[model samples]
Target: MEVTSPPPSLLLSDSDLEDCYDIIDPPLTTSNDGSTVSEDIHKSMDEFDRLINLDRARRKMALLNEETEKEEEKK
Candidate 1:
């Protein structure tokens, strides 16, 4: 089977398609890193939407990465 990159919608802005093929982020445990990150930056949904989008993109990309890895191994 031939491997293919994930569709564009499944990608994160900070990441390249090749990056996903090479490195997948570690799974998020019930507690991720045990710390609050980038706090105090958003006071309202208007400002917070970007962060929300990024988090969603990251999760989508990670799932796609895992799927791709599994397919590659099977091949």
Candidate 2:
């Protein structure tokens, strides 16, 4: 039987490895369209703020209703 060597595994050079970044790192902030990155960020932030405000509320008698954190609906 002829002896054959195993295929060489692909390995990066030391410099290449040093230049590589963590795989879990978020990708560069970018916009696929012509809009700028900052503009995209602002747009997303505005939408988030709107959604957050929807569930937000203030109690005038918070001092009286200090028993529970969530307000229950009167069924």
Candidate 3:
């Protein structure tokens, strides 16, 4: 026996959609489990900064490599 999938409209109910949105865009909380919130925020910010710097460095390296390749092609 073969089974067919449910229609897109019937796949997710209104409540399910709201739950998905809640997961995607959660409300920010100032304080949760005591003063650890600040520490968590600081750690996350540091991680974000590190990722941004890494991405910038990667772009610079890619551009430098492209320029080097072009110079080699000219020779």
RMSD of each: 25.2, 9.9, 9.9
Task: For candidate 1, give the lDDT.
Answer: 0.68
Q: Tell me the TM-score of each prediction against the true structure.
A: 0.41, 0.33, 0.54
Enumerate residue pairs that collide in model 1: none
Candidate 2 lDDT, tens digit per residue, 1-75?
999776656667776665674344524557566675667888999999987776453343564466444444332
Q: What lDDT score is found at residue 20 in candidate 2? A: 72
Cα error, residue 45 of model 2, in Å, equals 1.2
Off by over 4 Å in 1: 1-43
- Give lDDT per model, in order: 0.68, 0.63, 0.85
Residue-level lDDT tens digits of model 3 in 1-75: 999998887798889989998799764556655545556789899999999999999999999999999999999
* Most TM-score-accurate candidate: 3
The alpha-carbon deviation from the true structure for residue 28 of candidate 3, after best TM-score superposition, in angstroms, is: 13
Poorest 10 consecutive residues by lDDT, candidate 2: 66-75
lDDT of 1 by residue, 1-75 (tens): 999999988867755755774467542333354432223233355468978999999999999999999999999
